[model samples]
Target: MLLELRQLRIQPGQQLLLEDVSWQQFENILAELGEHRAARISYSHGFLEIMVPLPEHEKAKEIIGDLVKILLESRQIAFESLGSTTLKSDRMVQGVEADACFYIQNQAAVIGKNRLDLSIDPPPDLAIEIDLTSRTQLDNYQILGVPELWRYGKQGLKMNVLENGKYVESNFSPTFPGIPIIELINQYVQQSQVSGRTQAIQAFRNWLRDNI
Candidate 1:
C-alpha cells in the first residue's frame, strides 16, 4: 500500500476545477503563481482557464505549442491570441484559463512580474482562450481597453482587434507582422512535442537563419 501510494504521487495529478464554475474563479492563477495574497482581483469570469508565465517570445511559443498538444489529448478547449487585456466582467465569469497570453513591448519588452499594477491602464496587447466548457465573453479586449485580441475555439482561430472602442475583425498582426496565425497553430499541432515549439516559431518568423 505504501509503495502504491508513493507511485501514485509520482504521476501527474488531475486538474481540479470548481463545480458549477462561472467566470469568477479564474483566480487560480494567483494561487499558482504565489501572488494570491498580494493580488486584488475584483472579478474573474471563465469556465476553463490557466495562466502561463513566460520569459520571452520564444518561451511564449514553446508554452503555446505544449498547451495545444495537451488540450487536444485531453479533449480540452484552447485558444491562442497575440496580446490583449483580460476583463473582469461582473457577470458569470469563472473556470476560464487564458493560455499563453501575448503583449506588445512598450519600449523594450519588460519581463512580466507576478503582479502587474497597471495603475490606470497597462493591459497586454493580446490574449488567448481555449474556450473549453463555456463561452467566456468574446469581447474581452474592448472591456479591458486593449486594441487587439485573438480568439481560438471550436471553429478554429479568429482575430479581433478593438479599433475606436469597437472590436473589429482582423487577420495578420502588427504585433506579429506577417504571421499567418492559423499556420502557426497547425505547425505546433502537427510536430513532435520536443521539436514542435522550435519548428512552430521558425515557421512563423518572416526570416530565420540557422547557426550551428
Candidate 2:
C-alpha cells in the first residue's frame, strides 16, 4: 500500500486541505509523500492540511532556527534538532510537522533511538513555529503533549505552555526559564531583516554570552 503511493505523483503547492480523512488514509499519504518532500502536513481530529511553504515563510523559519541553535550552543545545553520532522501519535489522533523542534530536557531519552513513539518516548521539549502564510492549530500540539510552543508572527513572538490538555499564554518560556524569550527573539528577528541572517546570528551569540 505504501509502495503504491510512492509511484503516484502528489504535487502539493499552496495549501491542500481535506476534511473527514481517516487516520489510516492520512498515514498512507504521508508515507507516499516520503521523507525528502518539501512540504508540510498536519492532521487534527479528522482534518488534514498540506502546504508548500512560500519564500517569506522559509526566511522566517530559517532565522528562528538559526537563532535557536545559537542559543543552545551558547548555553552549553544538549539538544537534538529535528528540522520539520514528522511527529504523529495515532492514539492522540494528531499529527504535525513543526518549522523546527528540539529535544533539550529529554535529549538523552531520544539520543540513540531511530524511531520515536510518542506513547512511550518524550515529545520535543520545545517547538518553534513561524506563522506568516498559515496558522497552525495550537490544540493539536496540546493533544500531542508537546510541553512548549513558541509562535512567531507579524506582531511578535508568543510563548505557550501546555497545561492539562490546554495551551496557556506565557510571557516566559518553560524550556528556558527566566529568559526574556519574546524580547530577545523579536530583537534578532527584526535585526535579521536588516543585517542579514549570518550577521544577526553572530550579534545574538555575542550578546547572549555577555548576558549569560
lDDT measured at residue 152 in model 1 versus the true structure, 0 to 100: 54
- The sequence of per-residue lDDT tens digits that candidate 1 reaches over residues 1-212 is 22321132111212223234443334444444443221112233333423222233234445454543343333332332322223343332312224445444432233544334333335555655443222334544455555656555445566787778888888775555654656556445344245755665454342223210
Per-residue lDDT of 67-127 in model 2, one digit per residue for the tens?
A: 8888888779999988887788888888888899899989988887766667677899998
Best by lDDT: 2
Taken over the whole model, the C-alpha lDDT of each candidate is: 0.42, 0.82
Reference-based lDDT, residue 168, model 1: 82
lDDT of 1: 0.42
In candidate 1, position 188 carries an lDDT of 53
- Residue pairs with colliding backbones in model 2 are none
Off by over 4 Å in 1: 1-97, 107-113, 192-212
In model 1, what lDDT does residue 61 have? Answer: 41
